[model samples]
Target: MSTFTKPNHIGRKISRIRELRNMKQEALAQALGTNQQAVSILENSETIDEDKLIAIAKVLGVTVEAIKSFSEEGMINYFNTFNESDNNFNHYNTCTFNPLDKLVESFEENKKLYERLLKAEQDKIEYLEKLLKGK
Candidate 1:
């Protein structure tokens, strides 16, 4: 039997990318025609086979190398380097105007709209009660 080597920091990168893509494990599994538990295990750095890794990379829209390129120190150093950069404001400005930001803003607006709808329903119920009591 062949031994499986655990990927270095790929798990963290996969988790981060999944979040960035706004994907649930179940959704990703569906995209890959697999099961959520398998996706969870992959994200959590549990034992995984190469075929699973390839499927995940395809579903995540990233190269397998991109997923596997992360070293423990490399991950930390890359993030730290970005943290130390003075261009964060510029980067944030660019990201704020991205299509993803529009989607996020739209989602927030929908949430608010749903909240208002619920409140209106409650108010209507109260009004109907007052009318029934002739108040």
Candidate 2:
């Protein structure tokens, strides 16, 4: 016998994935062309029909196998990873530096340069007015 444990509660797994996706029973029911009461009954059961499971998976934007193997630990890990990213906006897995941060920095520098150029123009206009008055 294998020591690995598998999640077998298909209905509860579907419910959990739906909840994680921020979906309500009524919304899921609407997508599945069923009523909320029927969805409730399905979620409360241990097994679900394969056809219904396929429909539910499509509605939930997940695979049928994912629904069958969904676990609380996996959900928790996903949230933890998401929260870590939420806490640090600069952290992106694809690159060592955030391009958005660089863009914002470049924008600030350009803003300062534009302000300086505008001030210089104003100073030139003031000097021209002063010279005109003295002439």
Candidate 3:
């Protein structure tokens, strides 16, 4: 038997694009004014409304058609074009941003995620303690 792929899985496409950009669900959720759990559910869905998809694409720095046509093979090929074999790729990738800035940005985002998670745990514990005291 041959395995089949679902070509029209919009949510999976969104997720892949997000991952390729080195973004976390919590970051994306904050950008979308939603929560991480909602983002998780959205990314697991098969489809999204056109308007929302457009908004998501905008936040992702891609066009809706780009997200719609995203594929693993295409992504590989796209990254391959950035290899040293392509002299043109050097100008943009080399001159645009500092590597340390990217590292710091990643660290900041991770810190925010960790803080949010810790606060959530604390809230849960407090609620459970209240219930126990009531009983």
- Best by the lDDT measure: 3
- The TM-score leader among the candidates is 3
Model 1 residue 121 CA deviation (Å) reads 66
Query: Deviation in angstroms for 49 in model 3?
Result: 0.7
lDDT of 3 by residue, 1-135 (tens): 999975598999999999989999999999999999998999998999998898899899999999989889987887787684677756557757788999999999999999999999999999999999999
By TM-score, rank the candidates, best first: 3, 2, 1
Global lDDT scores for all candidate models? 0.80, 0.88, 0.91
Determine the C-alpha RMSD for candidate 3 after optimal superposition of all C-alphas.
23.2
- Residue-wise C-alpha lDDT for candidate 2, range 46-121, written one tens digit per residue: 8888998889999999998888878899878987997778747664445878999999999999999999999999
Candidate 2 vs. true structure, TM-score: 0.56
RMSD of 1: 16.4
Model 1 CA lDDT for position 42: 73
lDDT of model 2, residue 29: 92
Clash pairs detected, candidate 2: none
TM-score of each: 0.44, 0.56, 0.57
What stretches of model 2 exceed 4 Å from their correct place? 1-7, 81-135
In model 2, how large is the Cα lDDT of residue 111?
A: 100
